[model samples]
Target: MLALTLSLALGTPAQAQDADVHEPSPAERARPDDSVAGSEKLLLTAGVSELEGAAGGGLTPWAVIGGYGTRDQIGASAFYTRVNVPDYHLDGAGALIGFLDRIEFSVAQQRFDTEAVGAALGLGRGFTFRQNIIGLKVKLAGDAVLEQDSWLPQLSVGAQFKKNDRGAVLEAIGAKDDHGIDFYASATKLYLAQSILANVTLRFTRANQIGILGFGGDRNDNYTAQLEGSLAWLLSRNLAIGAEYRMKPDNLGIAGEDDWFDAFIAWAPGKHVSLTLAYADLGNIVIKDRQRGLYASVQIGF
Candidate 1:
């Protein structure tokens, strides 16, 4: 009688505890609503902001959407970048918002300081060229993070609309228009097991000096195809090193444009902030050739 009572007591508690437990359905587990406030994404997967305010490397856009947002969350981020060359300086600031990890909208402004070269060209000594950029990106197919078992990479298509303030100077220098648009498609693959990331972008544009000197010129006024590529190695969850190559259009005869290259290091202490520094070779800008410089950028947000 004592053993029977003891067993009943233990079995009653166990049965009550099992009845109190809840198991989530497969559908509920697949898309959890707890991913709000832009949380739950892996570090360095969204990438840093490029010059045009898109989520990408230092100079080119990537396939991933901006921020740490998942499928059911909204994310926001902002960034500032400065590039110092021997004869010039470029300052860029921008912000972006991601919706449901599928679409991104961004806005950016750029100021290019001419320094002594401006006076030599009959412009003011401290003359500056200002440009504004608005960008949009939409994910087309695949998932760089979730679909690791598949060979299909994440793909996105983006566009940038640019407007330059120096219309008179641009016209005098043979630029065809003061405002233009650029379109590109990017593919990105993240090899999680190998700690590697690779991206390739195909761009169609006519911008000169990336719109600092306006769009198109006497040399070439039509949109042409260009290529941009990046490769990165993740040293840890928070740190990555990468290199980028961007081919540019040589539209202006008065000033020959050259391809751009950069080796960069990006660090993300957390999901909310990141820092990137690089040695950039701009090749040629206006009268200056081999315009090597230091590039630094900071990004912050959810």
Candidate 2:
């Protein structure tokens, strides 16, 4: 009888212990649901809605705002770009300020340094020229992401007014002109986002960069149409690699047409800073040909 009683008591405790083992702890029950909620918030805050580059091509084209203030009604940004080649070097600094998320106004200054490596180009230490660029861009169409499902592209119309400071340069090069304003219009489209990306741009501008020493050529007071294209792939979250090609006109009589291409890599550590490095092949300018070199730029914005 004692043994039977002891067995019943032991079985009763064993059943109670099993029931406790199946019950979940309060901490464990709350963790998975909390983790899911946190992940959703992160996705909403950091979507693929940031602007990638400042320009449509080598020139800054109108692009939407990017990063933390991407959703804000107003934003501002600044950039410094340097291009070095065998015959020419250029440095440009600029700023862009946006208003009401619909319009952007920008100004930039460029310093051009040329080398005397070509035919009869004797003008004492080459020539130093300056260019002031003022631009205005207005959005005309759909949103960048909201209209993703539709066929319409986020459209913007932009104009660049360029002033050349060629007083000293023209006198040294035996040219009559001192300074002039060049106007241009640009149309840009961004297609296929995320992993694979493509951008197509067309610009019409009247400039004399092709005419070396300010000598008259096909580039003077003539509107020329150019096409620029880029294809990119996202390797990871903070890095992208791409290739670009530009088709430009041949306005200089001393050389063949100017056709160039570049391969580049860009890195964005955070929302406020980005850096790009590239290798470019500049076909020819003036009598000097096959000018190839490095290009780099850094951009900071808030």
Candidate 3:
């Protein structure tokens, strides 16, 4: 997410000076104020929940904190996402709560429907794989917005614990574990003058199919490093266009697991409502090739 919120904050010092020179207007006093001091009001650049329940793009997490909360208050957000690809469909829902812009807690539930492949494997058509995720994030470094002129970027560390319900199925398919954790470190930078935002994340994981097909197989049993990145352009206060790329490890030799990419557009109609639409390419999944799809998500926050 970009730090567009800084633009609003740049006026605070001036506003304070004006207050010393003249009496406040009735309208200014009558208007509703929902944010805390030291924190800007909701910025579209704060971003929405990611697939794994982190604040970021559709496929990867960014360093920005989530929700509308500031440094002195609590904020929360909920989201639902859907992706339809050839021979498969994925649905996810989650919620996140952030505290004082320093810590975040999240939970997510995902269901993957193996439309036709389920039948081919003799597991009835439309068989579904389910997973539950619990995540936590901690802010670790420089602010992406406040220190934009510097070479440093905002940094954070996070972890996601995943548990897949299809243990037997995964074991039968060569998976050695059904539950595991993924750890990641993310950095985000925003150049307000150029209206550009960029983020990079490094993750360590042993999961295949992002844990839907379980973790660590006989073919590969150790966690490995992977990279994910995003670049976005803030076209306006309410609109942003971006692209994301996430690399995956080919752990299970049963089939090739490839990288993922997406082009997306996000719109924030208000501080409490957001929507995102994207075109995604999930390379390959099991027997399916070129798993392209349409991705959509809706989010509400306070």
Candidate 4:
């Protein structure tokens, strides 16, 4: 009986050894992990840094164009804009730099043309007014993207410190002789994975731009709430069609200027380029119809 049991154990060992020799190794059986091992580092590095600045209307709050800096570094961008109205026109140019993916600094200058309206106000030919704006933004919490989950939204908070050039022309129109720093705070959120991409933003700002030359009565430093939103439908691999709505304040004491809004269609041909075309109804700016004939902007980034 002992010899029989020993023979069985010896036979089982030899058979097991033969099977092991034909089996695959653990490493050979494992599957590749795409997120951790196969991802392209440069592709992941791209973010807001690749987007151009806002387009069309000035009253509408566009998304923060370039937050492409890394988690602990900085990134920068520059842009130019033009707004042409039936009775007036404006040209603006600006630059922005972001730091540590948490803070941003920006400066912008705008030239406002008063056209024939300037003559009525006792000013010479079309008066050119300039505005210098500085701003800072802090990201509160939330990641713009997370491959593992689909339930969360990206969120951020920001403020702008604007200084109107308040040139001699602006002063002549009753604006404050001294420069003013208008303050504003905003909260923005983006909802991902929806068929119609959407972003909702809310802001409260204090300023007198709504009131020509900041001359309107009841236009003290008071915070006014505003809401802006956008929705886009992907038309193809590189094209998207969208619309935006902005609700503004009626702080201007003058009779013509008051509450207003803008409607627009934007196009993004690729990661590095975008453009927008729109029509704006600026309400009334001083007894004159202030509807902008057309508005356009081109944005390029890297």
TM-score of every candidate: 0.90, 0.70, 0.87, 0.69
The order of the candidates by TM-score, greatest first, is 1, 3, 2, 4
Judged by whole-model lDDT over C-alpha atoms, candidate 1 comes out at 0.93
Q: What is the lDDT of candidate 4?
A: 0.51
Cα lDDT listed for each candidate = 0.93, 0.55, 0.87, 0.51
* Candidate order (lDDT): 1, 3, 2, 4
RMSD for each of the candidates: 6.9, 13.5, 9.8, 8.8
Each candidate's number of clashing pairs is: 0, 1, 0, 3
lDDT of 1 by residue, 161-207 (tens): 99999999999999999999999999999999999999999999999
Please list the residue runs of candidate 1 whose C-alpha ends up more than 4 Å from where it truly belongs after superposition: 1-35
Pairing residues by index, what is the TM-score of model 1?
0.90
lDDT, candidate 1, residue 23?
87
Q: Which residue pairs show backbone clashes in model 4?
A: 48-66, 256-284, 257-284
Predicted model with the maximum TM-score: 1
Cα displacement (Å) at residue 58, model 1:
0.5
Candidate 2 displacement at residue 168 in angstroms: 6.4
Report the poorest 10 consecutive residues by lDDT, candidate 4.
43-52
List the candidate 4 regions with Cα displacement exceeding 4 Å: 1-59, 62-67, 70-73, 147-152, 167-178, 182-189, 210-212, 219-221
User: Which 10-residue window in model 1 sums to the lowest lDDT?
Assistant: 12-21
